[model samples]
Target chain A: MKFLGVIIVCLTGGLLLYGTTDFPDWGDPSSPASTHLSDYYIEKTIEDTKVPNIVTSVLADYRGFDTMFETAVIFTAGLACFILLRDFRGKKERFYRHKPTGVVLHVKDGKKTLTVGKEFEHMDKDWVPSDLIIKTVCRILIPFIQIYAMYVVAHGDFSPGGGFQGGVIFGSSLILLAISYDLKTLVNRIKEKVLGIFAALGVLIFVGIAAICMPMGGNFLDYTALAPLVWDPHHVRALGMLGVEIGVGFAVMAVMAIIYINIVSEGRHDEGL
Target chain B: MHWPIDLIVLTFVIFCAIAAISVKDLLGTAILFGAYSFMMCLLWAVMGAVDVAFTEASVGAGVSTVFFVAAVFRTSRRTKD
Candidate 1:
């Protein structure tokens, strides 16, 4: 199987290298990619959408339907991971270890509840002691990381980052918390059901904004038609773009967290690696 | 052509890619792959695609690496290769 994989990869690389021979010189302004709608997007994005970042303006405004679908794709990934993983059936037996005496006790049938005292603590079968340095540093840094993620999402119009990047960063922060502390710490902070709702809400927001434009008597994602509702016709596209980015951010964040949690837990949230 | 920096980074990228695949330890491979991603991100930044570079830095070097590490943690560390 590995040999076959190597052969396939080599073939694909060869094919790609052969295809690259017909490509224009690097950074050529006359290249098809730069000569096509990219030129128009560069020249007119600021004026058309009142957005300084041409990429965001083009992605969320000019080609909004595609962005909406992209958001849906992220949401679908989160949903798929949730469906594939997330075993809710409680474990038949729960185990506790006495820290002081080094004695292990197993509770059968979830009938008896063990009091989590200073000496007694609930433990997974294969549990590693948390690292002090990692836990401490991450505890201090996660909030700042999350704030930066939000800033990236909000300032996509003026910055290089957009919803997708920002959302991934945000989701990564949650994953970091899980890594530093444990999956229980993460699950306690943000429930699985809440993440599911967030994933769906993001796609709904994108679709809702596009659907709103339809009733306004314009095309599906026409922000110009939103002129009557908002104060300025020129700035409405920028606002619409921001809204779409926020939706994308939410979906991507939820999906990334979902994938991480499921994969780490191996479909059983009872314990995480 | 300002080839020095680009060539150096590209060389490192290829080296890391090969090293990652050749490594027997899956966790080590993941870290090397992350280094390769960082190099790719730098190349993109040099090409003036700040947005693509940013995405690669955050997603490729950051989240994907974490995911890879988490996956390795769940499974065995040793590989036949």
Candidate 2:
């Protein structure tokens, strides 16, 4: 404990302060970030894609390959989480968890073993937890939060929101459920198996959209080839970009949620995967 | 959206990160790290990076926190000197 305190004072405190210094001076008009590769996207994207939102253009069309890998990053994270945390016991092997011999007790039922650590405070099994009120609120809030995340994705062509934002919002909504209710509920409701699938599918969606352009294509993600029937290639391009955003959003949300779940529930146990 | 509010949010973020990393207790640090993510979300929103804001909020604030806690479980609380 004392060592960490000293390390933070010596190392982290200064670095944290350093990281925030000036920080591009808050949308400086002269900043390169506000000017170059993005400037082209901002100006040309709306005309080419017919989407008012410029960031979406950059993410999906201009540098979509980056987005695809970003999705893969999430996919890898999910895999890592599963490998780190998911319990794997052959159906025949009886579950035996190391409990704190003096105080911790283990109760097994079927495939699950709930450990009671010595330091754990006893609660009546039937008692509703204190966070239930917040849980109730989350139950009500989840649909709205999810809907808003989707809206962020759908409207990425218009304004400030896009895949990464929507993904975070989506992931947070699931986290709220875990926090307010219990992790067990979230695990049950959102199966670990499903999250892995979505992560992969997200990458596929982005790559698939881009690959379509190659055949009748101008470039890897040339949206004009997508719907040759559409008189305005811009509109078709915009639609394709939207699809890419949806994919990215799902991948990011699923993988992040998985990471959190692994850390919170199983990692603390300090057992080998 | 609000400048002062945003500044406050940013300040809180810095504070949390400092607290999280600096704290002697690993569990405390892990929990504070979660708070840092939530604050970062607010900072992203205020900066008009709504997409990054949402991602930070969800992953950093919510899920990442859980992951850290779980990681803590698998490891000892004390940092080996």
Candidate 3:
């Protein structure tokens, strides 16, 4: 059976490589894609949307409907992860550590809970003393990483990064915090409810901006219709794109956090890596 | 110049892909998958698709690797097959 599977995989891979042989050469000027809308987008993206980055303008302005659905798809993925993995049942065993002397306490009862104070802290089953170097370095670096992420999101019109990339970077910073410390540190800082709300809010911001355009005498996602709302009407499209990018950034960041938290904790919202 | 760099990255990508699948240790596979993603990101950058390269670096190489590690932490490290 294994040999048959390997043969099938090899055949499929060969067929795929063979299929690529018939395609246009890389960056062929007269290829179908280059001859068609590529020219228009390259030439007129700046004039049309006031965004210098053609990719940003094309993604958020010219083909915004597609991007909107992409945000919805991300939101749906987070929702699906939440629905499938979230475990509401309490864990039967809980561990707490006394901060002063590092005395570990284990409670076996599922119903009874302890009131954690300064002396007592929640501990994971695989808890080890968090390294001072890792914690200190991450503490110092997280701010810069977060700042760079915001820059990527804000400067998408003039640069390579947009909301998705920026959001992922920001989410990874949060994940880094979890890795350096523990999952409890992250969960305590950002609540599960807050993450869910932000995820939904991000998608709402995108749809809301798009929907507002329709009532303002333009088609869906028409930034030109948003001219009246902003102070500088000439750069309204750029501003609109920025707004949409921010919305995407929020959604992606929250969803990344939600998925990480859920998976690491196995829906219990407690001790994890 | 570009072709040589591209060729090197593509070779690494293929190598990582094969190694990741064949590795019996799931932890090793997760790290190899990350190496595969980083190589793919380099290939995308070489092709002048900077935006795609950025996405691949952050989403593919950065966060997804952490996700895989977290998953491995929760489950068994050894694969049955």
- Candidates ranked by lDDT: 3, 1, 2
Best by lDDT: 3
> Candidate 2, residue A264: CA error in Å?
3.5
Candidate 3 lDDT over residue span A90-204, tens digit each: 8999999998999999999888778899989888988888999989999999999999999999999999999899888988898888889998889999998999998899899
By summed lDDT, which 10 consecutive residues of candidate 2 chain A come out lowest?
A90-99
lDDT of 1: 0.88
lDDT string, candidate 1, B1-81, tens digits: 767999999999999999998999999999999999999999999899999999999999998898898889888998965
Model 1 regions more than 4 Å off: A1-9, A97-104, A108-121, A231-233
User: Candidate 1 lDDT, tens digit per residue, A157-259?
Assistant: 9989999999999999998898888887887799888888888888988888888988898899998777888877669988888888898898899989889
Candidates 1 and 3, the one with greater DockQ: 3
DockQ of each: 0.84, 0.49, 0.89
Q: Which candidate is the best by DockQ?
A: 3
Candidate 1: chain B TM-score equals: 0.96
DockQ of 2: 0.49
Show where candidate 2 strays beyond 4 Å: A1-38, A90-134, A229-234, A267-273, B1-14, B38-50, B73-81
Residue A217, candidate 2: C-alpha displacement in angstroms:
2.9
Candidate 1: deviation at residue A201, Å?
A: 0.5
